[model samples]
Target: MTAPASSAPPLPDPAPYQGAPERHPRRPRHPLDTATDPEAVELTAPVFGPADVDALDADLTRQHSGEPLGERLTVTGRVLDRAGRPVRGQLVEIWQANASGRYAHRRDRNPAPLDPHFTGVGRCLTDGDGRYAFTTVKPGAYPLPGAGAWRPAHIHFSFFGTALTQRLVTQMYFPGDPLLPYDPVLAAVPDPAARRRLIAAYDHQLSLAGGALGYRWDVVLGGPAATWAEEGRR
Candidate 1:
């Protein structure tokens, strides 16, 4: 006679825990890769605090008086890892002044025409391929906050991904900004080479099927060594 067989308990399904404990899948590289590299100086510290999300969103979504925010200029870009793989579903927020170089905020004090219909805030979410797009007017050149009072035309960008601790804050400069030399903030970026990387290139040929000036700017984030190694193959 065959020996009696014992019944064993069923194994727990892992589907529920798949992405629970781990970071978001959008970032292909590990957090270690982004933190250990000497090249990632600016990325070392978390720029935004946990308490900042609400305030940030409020600022980003508020409506401001401005010239009918010029018909939307489509801004498109990608978010990638140090290894250059697309980082999907990252949150991207953008803000800029109206064509008159005046912000909708009361603090702007530029006295320029405020289009009651136009506000500078916009948001976008990266797709699976790490691509993102949003519509906004091209910000005009404005005076910076200082004795020199000079600033180039630019846009502010904020980003967040699966890793809450790795939020980034940066500015995008338009090409051929004559005042770049006079801008203290732009000059403050430590690495001359990395500083140049922040300036966006203008492309007239990127017009949509309808002939809109499309701007493209990509963002690269640092990650763990293991993530960097994995990203290196591609």
Candidate 2:
């Protein structure tokens, strides 16, 4: 007989992450956000099949020719379902500012220096164990246009599930960041516990000797920790 078929149920439809109405003035919800935007009840088809994503999707550090500046970092984590089961072959995309907290986009008005070797974008697929990793520089904090408005160092993440409805985008923050609690963008997330889940924990064991520090952050698309993917973060 052929190898046994898997018995696990398909991942659950993630609960709609609710946000407090009060955040509108400071962080208005998008007009086409999932809450108000309606689409066909049928599961929207996936743009690409699992086969379309490959190993290159996982290693973002080598996109450029030279080494980026600032403290090097190796970020690692797994994608798991609510039951803590590894969800392999998920497409995960990450982009962040350079060590100086300056993005390489033309629209960025920040005066900080930009690293020539750092495109600040990476893609990777979770392996058999549902694990994914990337190497990058520790981004610095940046000041927003408004007075006393400084955004904490963070990396943007977009994870695509098997279907369009399964997708979610959020940001991952560094631990021990004092700016977190004060950021209006982050504050838009109503639940304190859910907010905490957005931060990645430092993992000395995963650190590179005398080099990059390491961080471990696992993501759960559905289940109890489903609240982890807080809203307000694009």
Off by over 4 Å in 1: 1-72, 208-210, 223-234
TM-score of each: 0.63, 0.74
Candidate number with greatest TM-score: 2
Runs of candidate 2 exceeding 4 Å displacement: 1-59, 208-211, 230-234
In order, candidate lDDTs are 0.62, 0.74
Residue 148 in candidate 1, Cα distance off native in Å? 2.1
142 Cα displacement, candidate 2 (Å): 0.7
Residue 53 deviation, candidate 2, in Å?
5.2
Provide the lowest-lDDT 10-residue window in model 1. 225-234
Q: How close is candidate 1 to the true structure, as a TM-score?
A: 0.63
lDDT of 1 by residue, 100-124 (tens): 7888798787767876666777766
